[model samples]
Target: MAGGVAAAVLGAIGGAGAYAYAGEVPRGTSVLGVDIGGKNRSDAIAALHAGLAKQAGKLGNPVAVRLGDRAAEVTPADIDLGVDVEATVTVAIEASPNPIGRLLGSRTVEPVVTLDEGKLHDLLGTALGKDARAMKQPSITFSGTTPKPNYPQPGRGLDAARSADAVRSGWLGGGPVDVPIVEIHPATTKEDVDKLVAEFARPAVSAPVTVTTERGDVTVAPAAIAKSLRLVADKAGRIEPALDAKKLRAALSTPLGAVEVQPKDARVAIVSGKPRVTEGTEGRQVDVTALATDLLAVLPKSDERTVTGKLVAAKPATTAADVAKLGIKERVSTFTTKFTGGLGAPRSQNIVQIAKDVDGTLVKPGAVFSLNGHTGERGYRQGYRDAPVILDGKLVPGVGGGTSQFTTTLFNAAYYAGLEDVHHKPHSYYFDRYPAVIESTIFWPDLDMKFRNNTEYGVVIDTSWTDNSITVSMYSTKVWDSVSTEYSPRRNITSPKVIKLPKGPTCIATNGIPGFTQDAFRVFKKDGKVVEREKFTWTYSAEPRFTCG
Candidate 1:
């Protein structure tokens, strides 16, 4: 009975012990759980600290966590827990039956863990926030002293602060920091301002002053004086001062003497000595002499007081009376008879008188006198010859036929005198009596022979007639050189032809006369050498004859 009671007691004790051991397990603690195994608050805190420490080490810096009003700092040193927390099952035995064969039950209890999460977060936040604060309010200092003559002193202080802010912002974990910039005024010391003034200022330049004697003026530039003084000016100052009267006087005064200033429009007049006369023709001579005196009074003279004059006379006029007295007498006397069987015999004195009157009118040198001007219109009542004269290619009696002889003679005289023949003509056909290329025939105004006095001296023509002959002579100033004419041989001649005509009278007419051409040349010679040779071609047309019945 007692053994049964003892067994019951032992079984009840064993059941109670089992129930107590099962109740000892942690409510929220687990081997692999939410917080990674911690039974108490302290252990959990310790584990969190260890985890954060490891994380801080891997991050290489403090970890910062912002709280409501403050930041928490976590660092490797604050959170590093070197202790290991491990659970083990230990059984406390009161008694054992066999030392080697004892069966014992065990119970597990978690080991104590320690963490410093608050300290770790506080340290990290402090360190990192301090760095951020330092970056926000950066400090800058200048070691060098301020320069003298600080024209822009305030700018230097601001520039130094800006440089420091730039460096601070460039660092990692650093941001734009608000820095208080203060200006430090260095002690002012005097420096030779001349060099600085010279550096910044402009030097003066001077313009040259000109004094002109001809224009009678003097000019001075204030800039020139400023240049001489080596003056310099600032941006707002004048480059140079204006020229005062005193300065002007000082500049002008010299050993040479002050420059004279004349009126702006000053002028001077100068006069010369008596006039001079020059050689000229009568009227021209008088006018030239007058001009000389007038010009002399107006011209400027340097020295002499005397002036000279000259006079020249024009050529004299030669009249018929003068030519008649030239002592040239007619050596040959000749007569040309114009007789027709039917025409009544006119008094021969009528033609003779016409020639005589014409001879009274003398032609002077270089004179071109027209026959019409000297001879009135020819009429029978006027004592002109009614004798047969060629009119419009028919036989008509008029005052002139033989008058042409007078012109021919005068032409020859002019030619011999070495005058320039201006106009002349030849007969329609060749005439046997006249020299080839030397003959000159005339018919009043139609065929006129005119010559110019090419020689510098004057000439006179003399004419006279007798009952049987007429003669003409030319008198001129003695020529230093002799003149002569030469003729070229005839050329381009055509044979003449004979023809019979049926007019009232039976007379044989030549159909064609031989054509012959020649050139006449006048050779002007001085001192036996030919100076000039003038040529004139005389073309002869074929002469035709008519046989009349």
Candidate 2:
């Protein structure tokens, strides 16, 4: 009998919970001064819409905002500032959940309002633009041959943060809101500008300055000084004057060119099938940094406008002693790729141009060399002619078309040299001109081939080409006794699709080639033992058959 009584009590509690969840909203609930108590979800939403509509009619009009003495009007709809009716109703329903609490509780919810602070800030800036002025700091810059001075000025602007809060709280109340306007002061004042101009700028451009170095003396004209001079205001409002080192160096180079001796870097060349090192020479040049400092010290002087700059010894980037220690004594690896075009052909010209740039490049030990980084952009500006290049599986006339052949040659040379392959991407489609899966394609700034000389010895890249073939050779201490490649049989073969198009300059008709996936392994041997083995794989897309109508 006790178990039966407990079961009846539990059933009554569950019924009460379900009725409360699905029943009308909690009693005596209100939002934005609108009574929505004891109503269903739909009825509550309808009541909120009807009641808020009347309130919006009064408050939705253009609101007047005052910033300092300036006044502007903004409509609530223009800034997306208004109350959300459905959201307000949702808050009311979720306020009281317990059945007993819903029966006895009375709650008031803040209305759900929407306001885009960013939009309101921008509106305030534009509306009160006359009253908003940015503080101008003192500065001096050149205007043609004369130095121009800009004086500092105090300003005033609307404080967007406090003003946004005011609009949020009072805009809905349907009254004119007063936005706070704050005064802005420049870090520097007009007095600083006047002092800088009088003591530095005026005298700096009055006469030519003479820089005496160990090599000789060079006179910089007054006009040159005006162009290279820079006067800027610091955070503490102090005016600072400085000479642009790069600009001054360029301006003084020609006049001092004869007296200055440029440094020469050591070079490596192949002589009698062996690497030969040429000694570098040290040269003397003007010390621009010290000259600038010295010039600043005497620039304001009326009579002593000459400054003596200490001549510092300029060393070559690579000295002969440095190159002699690099252990580049013999040819370590060499690779060649064949091309069919004649010397006058655009493709052949591009291939030769790239080979010229790649020739005589020295890769330091543990340094990664990138083809794109070294050669830069290969466009018409770089003298690369337009030739047939593969694009979207079709051959189109493009610049730097034949440079990829050179890239393939260089990749094979670096591969056999026992260097670490940092990054290399193969062509999307297979071409019979290049070795199946072992070749790489290159584009300006994007696709590239890179290799790192991981050995302790440096490697020198030497390139040579004939009308029909290009060869790349690397000279270094041979770490790998022998390097060879093993190939895996092609798989996942797919036939090309036949694509017909109208005959146009953009289309190049071709017989399609089959695509397949293949892998190549590079084995490095030292003392007749396998030291390292690297695996490379690529999947070639089937070249579509193009038939021009």
Specify the highest-lDDT model's number.
2
**TM-score of predicted structure 1:** 0.35
For residues 1-549, write the lDDT of model 2, one tens digit per residue: 999999999998887666555546776678777888878988988887888887877757888998777788888888888877788788877766577766556778777777777788889889887768776777998776566889887777755667778887777675789888887676777877877778888888888887776677888888778877778777444677888888888877787686788898898988877889988899887788877777888778787889886666789999888998999999999999888858999999999999998887889999999999999999988889999898777888999989999999999999988888898888888989888878899988878999999999999999998889999999999888899999999999999999997898977898999999999999988888998888999999988899999
Off by over 4 Å in 1: 1-354, 386-398, 466-468, 497-513
lDDT of each: 0.42, 0.84
- Assess every candidate by TM-score: 0.35, 0.56
User: Which regions of candidate 2 deviate over 4 angstroms?
Assistant: 1-239, 243-262, 282-286, 291-314, 501-504
